[model samples]
Target: MRPSASVAALLLALIVPAAALAQAAPCDGGSVFEDRNGNGRRDAGEPGLQGQRVSDGERIVVSDAQGRYRLPLRDNRSQFLIKPAGYRLANRASGLPDYWLNVRLQAGPALKYGGMPVATSCRDYGLIPERRKAAGDLDVLVFADPQTKTATDVDYYRRDIVEPLLADRLAGRRVADLGLSLGDITHDDLSLYPKLNAVTASLEVPWLHAPGNHDLDFDATRDEDSLLSFRHVYGPDTFAWEEAQANFVVLDDVVYQPGSKADYIGGLRPDQFAFLESYLAGVSRQRLLVLAMHIPLFDAAPGRETFRRADRERLFGLLKDFPNLLVLSGHSHTQRHVFHDAASGWQGAKPLHEYNVGAACGAFWSGVKDAQGIPDTTMSDGTPNGYARLSVRADAGYGLRWFPARQSDSDKVANPYLRLYLPKVLRRGSYPSRGVFANVYMGREDSRVEYRLDDGDWKPMRRVEQPDPAVLAENARDDETERLRGYDRAATATPSAHLWNAPLPTDAAAGEHKVEVRVFDPWQGEQRMSASYRLLDTAQD
Candidate 1:
C-alpha cells in the first residue's frame, strides 16, 4: 500500500533535513506505529511499537518507549523492522510483506530504467497479530535461483515447483511458517517482479529475499544503483530477522559495476561488513546465525573465485564468537554442503556449515520438456530442480531436506530421496572403473553411503568428487540435439560434491539384480534415505 499524503509529508520532513545535511550524515527515520485500521497510515488511537529492532541494513537500533527509531544510514539504505514474534507485516500492493522501507537519499546518474527517488522519511511498517513464535522448532522453505526469465518460465515455476510445495508445505498443518528465496528471482528482467511476487504469495508466508547478480539493474552506472528496482520492490537488499533461536541475515553479496552492461562480482561490500560487525556484537554467541546470500561465500567453479576470499575471511572473523552458525547460498545451480573451520578461515568451535542449495528453476529452465510441458531443468550437478525444507529446533540444531520437483502425475518412487544410477549391462566378472553412482542430492562429504547388490551385504560407497554421469549425458544431449526450444541451454556439468561411486561386484550372479543405495546423513543422523536401481547382467542376457 502506498503511503497517504499526510504520512508521506511527515516522512518527507524527517528525510529532507537529512538529505540537506552532509550526504554521509547519519540519516535517521520515523517510528514503528500501529495501524489500527490496517491502512499504511498513522491514524488516531494508534500507538508506536516500543523497544522493537529497526535497522538501516547495517547497524540496528531499537525503538524508544515512544516507538521512535533513528538509523545511522551510510549509503542507499533501506530501513527494515525486525518483526517481533507474534507480529506479522501488513501486505503491500504487490502482496509482499511490508517489513521494509526504501530510504534512498543519495542519487546517481539517471538511466534508461528508473532508479529510487529521493526519500524524506522511511515508511513505518504496519503489523497485525500473529501466533507468537520463538527461535525454536520451526520449518522454513528455501528456494534457490527461482530465476524465471519469461512468463512461460514463471508458469513452469508455479506449476512444477510452487504447486507441489504449496500442497506439501501447507498440508495437514502449516509446519513451514516461513520461506526464503535465495535470489536470482528473475533473470535481469525487473518487469517480472510482480509475476514472481504473485506466485510466491501463494506460499502464504512472509518470505525473505537476497539479491543475486541477475537481479542487478543493467542500466545503472554505479553499484549502489544496481539494485534500485530490486530494493524498490523487495525492500532492503541486506537485512536481518530473528527467529526462535536463530538470526537470519539476508545479504546482497552481488556487487555490480555498471558499464556497457553491469558486470558482477560476488563479495560483501564494506558497508555490509561494517553492518555485520555491528549486528553481530549484540547477538548472543549461542544463537544460531544463518546468513543467506545469492552468491556462495566460497568458490564452487574450478579456478574461479565465485566469492572474494578476503571478504569471506573478514566475515569468518566476525562470526568467530558465534558457535552455532550456518551459511546458505544459491547461485551455482548445484547442490552441495561446505564446512568451514579454522583451516577454512573460521575460528569457531564447530565447523561452519553452508548449504550451497540447488536452484529452483534448475539450469535456468533448460533441457527437454516433460509431459506437463515444464522443462526438466535438472542442475549441472545432477540435482533435480527443487527446494529445501529446513527444520530449526529450539535447541538451535537444524536439519535440511532437499525436495525434488514432482516428476509427473504417475510418479511413484517409494524412496525418492536419492538418485541411483546402475550399469545397464555388466558382464559377470568384468569390473568397470566407475561402477554405480548415487547422487544423494543432500549428501555431505562425510555422509555414510552404502550399497548392496541384490541380497549381498551392504558395502560402503566411496565419496568421489566428480560430475554425475546423468548430468553429463543431459548436457551432451543439449549439445548434440538438432533443435532446442528453451531460452537457454543447460549449464555444463561440474564435479558434484555430494556424489558417491562403488565398483560393480565382479562375483554377482548373471541375472537381473537390484542395487539398493542408502545415505545416512552426517549432520542429521536420524535422516536415513534409500533408493534402488535395476542392474542387468550381460552374461545372462
Candidate 2:
C-alpha cells in the first residue's frame, strides 16, 4: 500500500534538509498530478499520476504511487518531463508546452550572451489527460539550421516560414502533431532565442530543439558549460519523447573543445550515452526509433571525419536491436540522404537511413532581396530554403516531403519538387550535345528520373556529379555585376547530389518543343513538370 499524499509530504520534508526546502534548493522536486479541473495547478481532489517519467538531464526517475519524485539538482541543468503518449502539458505564456523547469547557477561564469536568468522551482507538473485516438500515421514538422543571426532574420523567418503554416492551421488544413528543429536555432546570437521561440510557439505545437555548434557559449572554459544559454531557454540538451507512431530522441552532438584548433567536434558525451542506454532498454522495438541531431553521422570530407568514429560505432551498436530506425540531422546547408552499411560500422538488419535536411536560412540567409524584402536564401546545392514534413506510419515506416519557403510564380514549370534549366533557342539540326538539366530537390541516387520530347518515348536521365547550373548561373550574375546584389552574395555552386542530365532531341521538326520531365519520388510518388524550348532557323537570320 502507498502512503497518503500528506504522509508522503511529511516523509519528504523529514528526509530532505531544511536548507534544501527553498525553491532553489540543491534537492528539489514535487508531485505529478492530473489537472482534473483544467487549471494549470493541482487542486483539491486532483489525483496524483503514478509512473510518470521525469529527468534531470543525466538521470531519469519515475513517480511513486503517490505521484511524487525527487532528484538532486545540478546548477544549469534542467528538470523536464518525458511527455507520455496520451497526455498533454499545460502551455506557458509563450504557447510552448510547460514541460521543463530551468535551474540556473547561483554564481556562474559571465557569458557574452547573458547566461540563464534566475528561476523559481517548478514544484508541480500538471498534465491534462487526452483522449486516446485510434492508432494511425503521425506527422511532424521538421526545421533544421534556422541559424538566424539578427533580429531582422528572425522577422524574415516569422513572415516567410511560420506565418504560412499558422495560416494553414487556422484555415483548418491538416497540420503536424508536433515540431522539431534539428539545431543551429540561431547564428551565434543566443539573445534571439526568445524571439525565435515566440514565433515558433504561435503554431501552438510542442517544439523540441537540439543544440548546434553555433548555439554554444564560447566563453565557457569547458564543454559542459557551452550550452548555458540554450539550456535556460530550451530544456535539456539531450532528451526523449514518445508518440503513438514513433519514439523520438534529441541529442546535443556538438562537443565544444575550448581553445582547440577546431572549436567543436560532433560527438556524444558519457552522460548522454548513459541516459540513452537506460532509456532505450525499456523502449518498444515495435515503433520506429528516430535520433535527431545537428551534425551528420557521416563525414563531410573523404579522409577527414566530422563526427567521432568511436562514438558512432558505440551508438550504432546500441541501436542494432531496434529494427525500425531513422536519423535526422542538420548543419550542412545542402540536403542529401545517406545510408549506413558495414563500411560505416552499422551492423543493423538493413542500411540505416539518415536524411540531412536543408537549412531554414539557406546559405546563411544570403542572396538578392525578393519583392517582399526577404533574401532569396537558396542553398548551394540548388535546394531552396525550406522545412521537411515527416510522416510515420503505424507499422513504423516513415516518409518525408520537403517544403520550400517560397515557390517561384514565374517558373515556366511550376512543379514544387523540381526545377529545370534549358536553352531558350537551339539550332534545329545541331549536334545533340546540349542537354536539359534537372534539379530534383528531394532526389536520391536511386530515384528514377526520365524525360520525353513532344510526347515521344521517355529516355532515362543520367545522374551526374556537377554543380547545379541554376545556382552557377546565379553565381555568374553576382560576379559580373559591380553593384552589390544584396546584403551578401548567394552561395557559390557546389556539386549537387541530386542533379541529372539528358540531351535535348534537336533532330525532330521543331518550332517550340515541349520537354516533359518526371521523377518517381520515394515518398511523394510520381511528380512531373513541363518546359518548352524554341528551335531557331539560322537561314532566316
Candidate 3:
C-alpha cells in the first residue's frame, strides 16, 4: 500500500542515518604525529608525521600528507610502525616501546593460561624527534633464553643478570641504544611475562622479543593460535624496525603442531613471507638487513631438518638482493656461528652469517649456587652464561663481543675472552705428553691461537674436538657428591666448538714457568691470558 508523504519521509530519514553511522565508524585507524610536548597524546599544535609506514602484520600503508592512515581491520592481529630513523617512539611505563596497537577479539581462544584481553583503542602513535649519529652508529644488547620457570628463577635472573647492567646504567655509564631478547622469555609459564618485562624494562631501552617454543599456549589446537598469549603481551609476533645502521626484522620461526609427535618445527608462515616480500622490496640494499628469530635457519643436526627447507629457500630468494645481511637466533642454549652458502640455498653475494647466541639462563639456571646465591649455570658446550654486545658502524660493518655473567676483579690474570686449564705441577724431563687446554669462548674453527712459555717463542695451539676439561672437571665433582648441588646439577659436558690444545714442555726446567696464551679475535683484536705451572725434579718429587 502506498504510504502518505510524511510517513515515507520519516522512514527514509531513519534508515539513511543508521546506514551512514555504520559506514562512518572505522574499526582500525589512527594518526602518526610528532609529540612536541613529550606527552604521548596529540594535542593542539602537534603536527602529523607524513610518509610514515604502518602495517597490519601483512599489508603496509603509508601515512597521507596529513599523517593519517587506515587499514582493514584484522581480527586478533596487531598493527605496528616501521620506525623511521631520526625519530623514536615513546616507551610505555613498562619500558616497552609504543610502536604497536593491538586489534583483539571480544572473546579470544580459551586456553589453559588466560588468553588475550579484549580489544583496546590505542591506535594513535606519538613519535619524538631524536638526533641520531651519522649513517651507521648503533649499539645493541642481545640476550637469549632467560627461560625462567618460577618466581625463584625470575629472582635469579634479576639478581644475576639485570642487577649488573642496571648498576652500570645507574652509574651513568654508556648503555646499548637498543635491546633484543631472541626468545624463551619464559619457560612455559605465560603468567611470568609481566615480571620478566619489568626486569628487562629497568634497562631503559627499547626492547624487542622473538617468540620461542617455551613462549607458547599449549591448549591451542593449531599453530595459528599458539602465540595468543605472546601477541597479547608483546604485540605482533612478526614485525620490523629500522635504524640508521640497519633494518631489523623479528620473525616467529617456531611453528607449533598441537597434536603432532614433533610438537613444533622451525619455519616462517605464509603471512610472514608476505610481509617480508612486500617490505623488503622497498628496503635499501645499502643498509644492513638483520633478521632475528628464536630458532635458527640452519639444521641443528646433520640429515635431520630442524627448519623447513622450502621456507628457507623462499626466504633466501627474497634476501638475495641485499648485500649486507645478518641473522641472529637463540634456541640451542649453547652458542655457535653458522655460515650458509649455495648448498644451503643461500645464493647471496657471500655466505650468510648466523649467530646462535648463548642462553642468559645457561643450562636452565642449574649448578651449585655461589656466595651471591646465583647458580653457576655454565652451558653444556662450555660457554659461560652471558650476553652479547653488538656494535654497528657507518660502513655496513658490525662487531660482536660476548660478556660472561661473572667477572673477577681480584684474580691476577682476569680475561673474559677465554678460560684456561693447566695442571699445577708435572714431572721434569718426562715424555711431555700432558697438555694445556684453552676454551676460547667466541673462538671459531679458523681462529689463530698461540701460547708462549716463560716469554719464549710463541707456539701454535691446535683446535680440538672434545669436551672442555674445565667443565668436565666440574661435572666429575657433581657426580662424586651425594647431596644436591643446587636446584639442579650442572649440565654434563659436550664437545665444544672452540676448545684448543697445546703440549706443555715439561723438559724445559725444574722451576715454575709462566704460560701466556693469546688469540687474534676477528672482532675484538688480540686477547691474552696467563697461567703458571711448575716442573719438579724426580728426586724432589
Q: Which candidate comes out best when scored by lDDT?
A: 2
The TM-score of predicted model 1 comes to: 0.87
How many clashes (backbone N, Cα, C below 3 Å) per candidate?
6, 0, 0
Task: Flag regions of model 3 displaced more than 4 Å.
Answer: 1-29, 120-122, 132-136, 408-413, 539-541
Question: Residue 6 deviation, candidate 2, in Å?
Answer: 31
Q: Mind giving the per-residue lDDT tens digits that candidate 3 earns over 1-541? A: 9989989968967866855433223545588999877677888999998999999788898888878988655666788989987788887766798888777646777997876777746477788888666554789989999999999999988888788788668989756788999999999999998999999998888899999999999889888889988887888999999888888999999999887889999999888999999999898777788999999998988888899999999999999878899999999988888889998999988999898899999999999998989999999988889888888886779988888875522335457689899999999988888889999988987899999999999999999989988889999999899988888999889988889999998778689999999999999899899999999888743
Which residue window of length 10 is worst by lDDT in model 3? 19-28
| Model 1 C-alpha lDDT per residue in residues 1-541, reported as the tens digit of each score | 9999989968977867755454544544578877767777777888988888888766688888878887655456787888765566777888777887676556745754466666646556666655565545777889999998889889989998888767745666463678899999999887888898999898777789998888888887678788888888898988888766677889999988655343787888887887787777777656578899988887765577677888888888888778788888999889888887675577778788999999999889987786778888888888888888888887778888887886422356633457877666656566555478988888888888898777679899999988898888777877887887455776678888889998876565566667777778654453334434333555453
Candidate 3 is scored at a TM of 0.92
Which 10 residues in a row give candidate 2 its minimum summed lDDT? 406-415
lDDT of 3 at 250: 95
**Where's the lowest-lDDT run of ten residues in candidate 1?**
526-535
> In candidate 3, which residue pairs get closer than 3 Å at backbone N, Cα or C atoms, i.e. clash?
none
